[model samples]
Target chain A: MAEPCTRWDAEGRLATERGETLDAHFAACPDCLAARAADAALSARLVETGARWQPPGDWEARVFARIAREAPARRFSWWYALFPALAAAGLAVFFFAPRGGGGPGSPDPSGAGFEVQIGVVDGAQVVRSENPKPGDTLRLTARVPTRDPARVAIRIYRDDRTLIFACGGGEVPCSLADDAVRAEVLMTAPGAYRSIILTGAGPLPAPAGTLDADAAAARAAGASVTLGEAVRVW
Target chain B: MTPTEDNPTTPPRASSDPGAAEQAVLALLERDDRRGALTALMRLYGDAIYRHCYGTLLDADLAADVHQTVFVEAWRDLPRFSGRSSFKTWLFAIARHRCLDALKIGRRRRSRFTTDDDAPEPADPARDAETDLAARSMLPPLENCLGGLRAESRTAVLLRFQESMSYEDMGKLTGELAGSLQARVARAMPVLRKCLEAAGVSL
Candidate 1:
């Protein structure tokens, strides 16, 4: 056996200090060279063993094609659900802006006695959902005067549109958690700003791509619309 | 053989430093050339990710599925990646979680057996695990020694040597602190050394 090395011991313990000294000694020592070669071989073997189970050669192309197929459909699906609400909110803006929103259980003209507080999830606790950064989960909660499950629709816009996520609208079912109608949307897309919440008892329908009449028609319906704003940082 | 960039259907024979390739992907992202970014990303990381998934799950079919899923999800999440960590770290974070999730499902199916210290981690086949390890390895003794390590220790060692990850990057990928990771690898070396000795292999 070679004489004991000063840096790393005979027991194969590495010195915590004098790293350069060990490196210097290891470079010149034949036995140390052998040990390093063995370690290197071990690493190479691990890699070679892992290579036995490699995935298909065209995996990247397959994933790209899958993404291409899904991207437009995802946006279209969201848009298909959103067009009616856009009209509902547009008309609700004119009608509800004059009457104003309900506060707590007060007898307001809009009949929307629900308390709505929108917040972004910040780790453990939830904070107000205004001025959200991109990649935030926006939790929009609305408590109605009674436990009848309020229909909450939230749309956020920058210029024309940025995000539109609504529950209890069209085919989207209302999330009835804590006896309140709640909708949690994960905002992944960047460049989205401003948010509007619409609360109603029933479905808000629109012909979609129609005129301002849809909004006026929404006013005639018993629904109440509440508008909030979110300035999203890209 | 030198692999051409235009058609990378086959992986390179040797692993490469991904730094320049990662930079290229980032540049494409900056120019908003998502198609180019996708191409660059796949060419750069595709093989590494496949190997990673296969290494963790030890199932070729499952590894392919997860590999595809990671890239598809990467397309969605890459925009908001925030640049806080290297792209590989982000990608491997996704792979690690996917593999562990698969293992959890497998474990549940096998009656929720807890892995004790020194108990060989199951390589799926209950009877021929040793045979499987040996057959896959160029050095059967070294492979057996590696397989004998705890799952986390094995992962740590592989990421350090095979994947060429710094302890800090490994920490970011695995959500463990870097010092603990250092201690872990340091602790693992002696075990590996002792193991080879027990197997009558010269170090």
Candidate 2:
């Protein structure tokens, strides 16, 4: 039996390795000739129509303009109106709670003074807020004073489980940006949560159970740690 | 920290490499020039995205809506974009999800993808100006045959033929295995062949 004709069958030979000009085989095999012709024709048609479905000329301008006009998902919710109060409230409640070192004049081991800002994910834009609605994705963006490489992580303390964001894992996703070390934690449900940012020359220390415990652990991490900032989520 | 000096927005797209646009986008992003980055990105992937949305959704308004949503979502996620996947792949991933979401809502009646293949083609609908299908009384036979295909097969064929995407790239965009995409195109071919034959259209 002759080998079946396919594209690999080249120059009309069903099995060329046997070194036969199989022109007689192709002549006898009408199905093979028709199939081959049909395949080539189909391929040609596909190529011909490849450039057919061009998008409209104004598509780019119109789409970009629409993007410009429709704001990012910044509905701001009802809570945006309460930012000033929330900011002050955070300073009182969480700020004074307990901070170990790396303050304004504290031993500056990392050589960088950092400002940590927290916000809710509004579309791709992160709107700065210490108080984000329950279920809001919490974005962490911080500026370290030094140009040195600094690794940043976020540990959000919840009643059930303390979530940590450091390079990997979906629970708390963290990716170190070149200019800004950024992380985002999904605050799944409305609950009491205390979120803290941990930065270090090396890897950050894992949380030690509770928010306060984690804070103590961070402070103990010492010169190994870059900087720390905490936010209280109501 | 924002760059003290704005990095050059002019893209470093060397002529030789295929990934030049993506590189340009990354360069803009590295400079913290988001607006510039967006411009570069839109220029790179905008047409493919808009076409995918339109072809998948089959309605001008819904496709336009999804196209904008995908870009808006892409802009929002720019800070978080880790470049883990090729920018084109990642953006199409978003496009696919938004398309699914629109489908789930039964948005704009997907009858374009759903109407029976044997049934008469629904009166062709909407803006020829937006579609560039103006001044045509009816689509050519192949197009009508293409529209008659099952949605998945139609999408596979169109992406292969119209968008000129490889099976691997289509797999990444559609979340289907490359082999599955290959089989889809294969399955589509015979249906297309039969339809074309019935229409008395050669090739």
Candidate 3:
């Protein structure tokens, strides 16, 4: 039996670089040849008509202005070099700051001793810690590194799975929750933890250091913490 | 291979006629006269790019956006243009990528004004008939037939027939291998042809 002819159309082929194989087939196949002729007629008409359409007034100028204004800043910035230093300081403060009971690395006062810090991450921000244990609390403080003052979203993933997420929405200077930073979720089992702070809707993976420290600090800080069936902390 | 061992004696083919405009634009841009370059590009290929975009997008507003983006991106990346390919070809490549992306976005957003709905009203059937009576147009029937194709088919056809680019270039723009692209085009032609013939177009 002859092979069944597959359904094909001109638009898809036209979008392709090399001319369509269907065109070659059409050159021989009477049915396809007829269709190709009709398409050619319609294309010319559309092209002629489309050429007359004009853009809105001042659109080009506006686009030009926007491009000019944003172009230079999009280039490499000098502030990139100071990131590690700033991160060290933030991590030091987060590690050194008194926990829920007023002692450095103290577990949550009420809940399972988990404290999550949510805030803007500056270019210089970093998370730090030594060792982490279960029942211990982890405290995170983020400082987003953007001059625009837009709040970024913080999402934590443990062992490649989501754990907690917090963001200030549109509020300036970012936001923190009542007891924790923004929101907190417990990690029942933890091997390697990751927190990704996205600048926008798309997945902008936080730098490698951002999450390692948050998870490590959370584990180390929360060591020796007791858990209740239902406990509520800020 | 060393230049002496290779076909070094052969002369380079002159660049496409359209490349002169790009060269001129580059010269002006190099002098920091981006405005002049924009004007020159507009004058040289504005109508072609606009119409091509319109054909691909099927909406005037979207076409305009694509046009603006193409030029803006072109200007921004002009400094990085290495001149490895013909300028017009490069521009067309950019336009093709933008058109495909715009179409994808439009589809995801459930766009209504596709190329299928963008046919021009015949100003005068009698006059057009009279003009067609004398002028031997190559692809009128095919154009109307394109509207009936799936989005992918329509785009492929337009890029191939209207823009007249090589298969290799299409592969680069669409991220499809040559064999795959060829297979798709082969599969697409019959549907397009049948649609065209049904639209009262002569083979």
Most TM-score-accurate candidate: 1
Question: Judged by TM-score relative to the true structure, which candidate is superior, 2 or 3?
Answer: 2
Candidate 2 local lDDT, residue B30: 86
Which whole-number lDDT from 0 to 100 does residue A113 have in model 3?
27
TM-score of 3: 0.45
- Expressed as tens digits, the lDDT of each residue in B50-104 for candidate 1 is 8777666655677798888778767766665566667777777767666655654
Q: Is candidate 2 or candidate 3 better by lDDT?
A: 2
RMSD to the true structure for each prediction, in A, is: 15.2, 17.2, 17.8
Q: What would the per-residue lDDT of candidate 1 be over residues A32-150, giving only the tens digit for each residue?
A: 66665665666676667666656687776678778878887654321122223444434322111112244444233344334444567777567544334557776655544332223
Superposition error at B196 for model 1 (Å): 5.4
Q: Which residue window of length 10 is worst by lDDT in model 1 chain A?
A: A91-100
Best candidate, DockQ-wise?
1
Tens-place lDDT digits, model 3, residues B85-130: 6556556656765776576444423322323222211223354444
True contacts kept of 1: 0.33
Residue A63 error for model 3, in Å? 4.4
Fraction of true inter-chain Cα contacts (below 8 Å) kept per model? 0.33, 0.16, 0.16
